[model samples]
Target: MSPIYFSLVTILLSIITITHATTITVVNNCDYTVWAAADPGGGRQLNKGNTWNLNPAPGTKMARIWGRTGCNFDGNGNGNCQTGGCGKLVCNPGNWGTIPKTLFEYTLAQPNNPTDTIDISLIEGFNIPISFSPTSNSGALGGNCRTIRCTADINGQCPQNWRVPGGCKSPCTSQGIGTCGANGDSRFYKQRCPDAYSYPNDDPTSTFSCPSGTNYRLTFCP
Candidate 1:
């Protein structure tokens, strides 16, 4: 129970937290190919029924996974995408990609709370419908586990101004993020995909979590 020993033990725990890994299986359920990309994980070609597994380092923040539609990467893995492109096939760590695109964002365990925090963010925009959920059924850290989805046909119903080649631009993407509102176009998005973030500030209803060490599945067009 000595002070010095306690400090050493705390440091060890912190190291463990930072070095651990969490698995996320990114699957493309779309009939077409989806270039799956991730900041901190990189990108891969996911054809129909194909999957890409990502193991993000623990204690990582602002980590995200997204699908790039209508991509044309050459054999060298270089090309842009119609939506959610990060300039190349293999995204640099922390690349947010050229958004106006939907996102599966998460932050794994940290010192404060040893649980994974995740959400489906449409704040950037919505290209493809997405579903994110914990693979485990052991319940979340607090409540019963559940899936978060933005599987509404938003592209078919996107407002004229929000319409893009392969995605629907969020109000924040159309207007400046600071001027984004909860009403107006945002409401249209929220009404359909209530569980996903429709605007820049949607943490209260959109964020979800799971126990530490839980794996996840990310599906496009699901």
Candidate 2:
């Protein structure tokens, strides 16, 4: 091939590679509507049995997705939510979802590597049941490439002092616990969801990684 032809081919391949994106599907199985919120992708209302598909920018490595309940928004994306409110239809990329909400955390493809980190985190507390799983089975890189969830009805069993209307606050936030070790609240959450991050430092068994190209699905109230 001529030099110019080779250069053009390389450019085209680069464009194609840059355009490729990882798919993330969010599904709602709750009886009521849930405002699905993400840092980079913003927010959207998902009624029961609805699904929202997102393709975040490749540069967006770390992101969080959660559900907000009891929201009232206008056509212009102006509104408030009872939980995880960002005051708009599409949450600002700079804004974070409220605490006492379950979070699906992800670290997308890194430089020169095809591995992606994923986990269901209860460190912010629990508002609803959630599960994170790889949609495709091809990226099973051993150890952490498995489905994880916090399906327990934690709100119903929340301790009186940590109980909130729609969620349960972690004792670390409510009772000023030092860490999530050997504490009643930590024990409560860990016992229910062993695969989730019950505290900030919980990583040995909580974090998991998979091949970057693998698609992901997050289900709410599952």
Which candidate gets the maximum lDDT versus the true structure?
1
Off by over 4 Å in 2: 1-20, 175-182
Show model 1 residue runs off by greater than 4 Å: 1-20
* Candidate 1: tens digits of C-alpha lDDT, residues 1-222: 999999999999988665455788999999999999898888998999999998887788889899998888788888899999988899988677997788888898788987788888888889999998788744655663578899989999998978889888888875888778788778998999999888777878888888777888999988
**Model 1 pairs whose backbones collide:** none
TM-score of each: 0.88, 0.89
